[model samples]
Target: MADPQDRRPAGAAEVLERLGRLSLRELSMESLLQTVADLATTVLPGDLEASVSLLVRGSPTTVASTGQLAVDLDERQYERGHGPCLHAARTGELTMIADARTDDRWPDYTPRAAERGALSSLSVPLDIDVDEQVSGALNIYA
Candidate 1:
């Protein structure tokens, strides 16, 4: 009998192989960013903005994004140096803005998010490096 993971599908097998390889060595940062953005757009169940941001030398920077809203928000955070995701990256915690219009954080960025039709968002830190130094973040928005 074929292994379930091997029998899933051609693309699935390829992805699994890639992930397995990733686990053994340092992942190409660009490849990882692209993979997450592609998953956000095609695999995820909902219509929401998605992003991947990396912490380089103690600074957060957006590496990839799936939607305009998310890209803009990430840019805002990068430019202004503030946002829920930024805070989350710093503390290595999940962060959410249930309703950006009412959220007190990101005084400048929230309005821009609202103007762009983003109502809420969730941000989670991704484990990339040892010691969990908040290598990056995954964000979902609606």
Candidate 2:
């Protein structure tokens, strides 16, 4: 069988166009998050894994993920209460780890992520209005 990653869209434009066609307002939050995760994996470089982490009932949860690896990585961060995705969701800032194994910031998270085959990661905050009780981060792992 062919590698599934090889079938993803080759360019950001294609991903963007696909996303733009979605009726976001009509979709449930779960569906929207799944679409975002799918687009992230398709648009981003490398053999990427993608997930969306969101605060549900004041607890962080992986709302949607491209693969089990993404969900597992997010769970690790949630358990530790720190990681690129959690930091981004809480601070509304972008966090990029060029190499998780060598990143000293999250001594707990990096090694686990590296062990899971995630060499690098990027986490970007999702802009939800203040009235919305949801804080989210788009996490891409490679």
Scored by TM-score, the top model is 2
Q: Determine which window of 10 residues in candidate 1 has minimal summed lDDT.
A: 1-10
C-alpha positional error of residue 117 in candidate 2 after TM-score superposition, expressed in Å: 0.6
TM-score of predicted model 2? 0.90
Predicted candidate 2, C-alpha RMSD: 2.4
lDDT of 2: 0.85
Model 1 agreement with the true structure over 17-128: per-residue lDDT tens digits: 6556554255576766756665544433445767888887677877777656777888788888878778777777999889988997788988888888888888887767
Model 2 residue 141 lDDT score: 92
Q: How many residue pairs clash in each candidate?
A: 0, 0
Q: Note the Cα lDDT for every prediction shown.
A: 0.71, 0.85
Candidate 1 vs. true structure, TM-score: 0.72
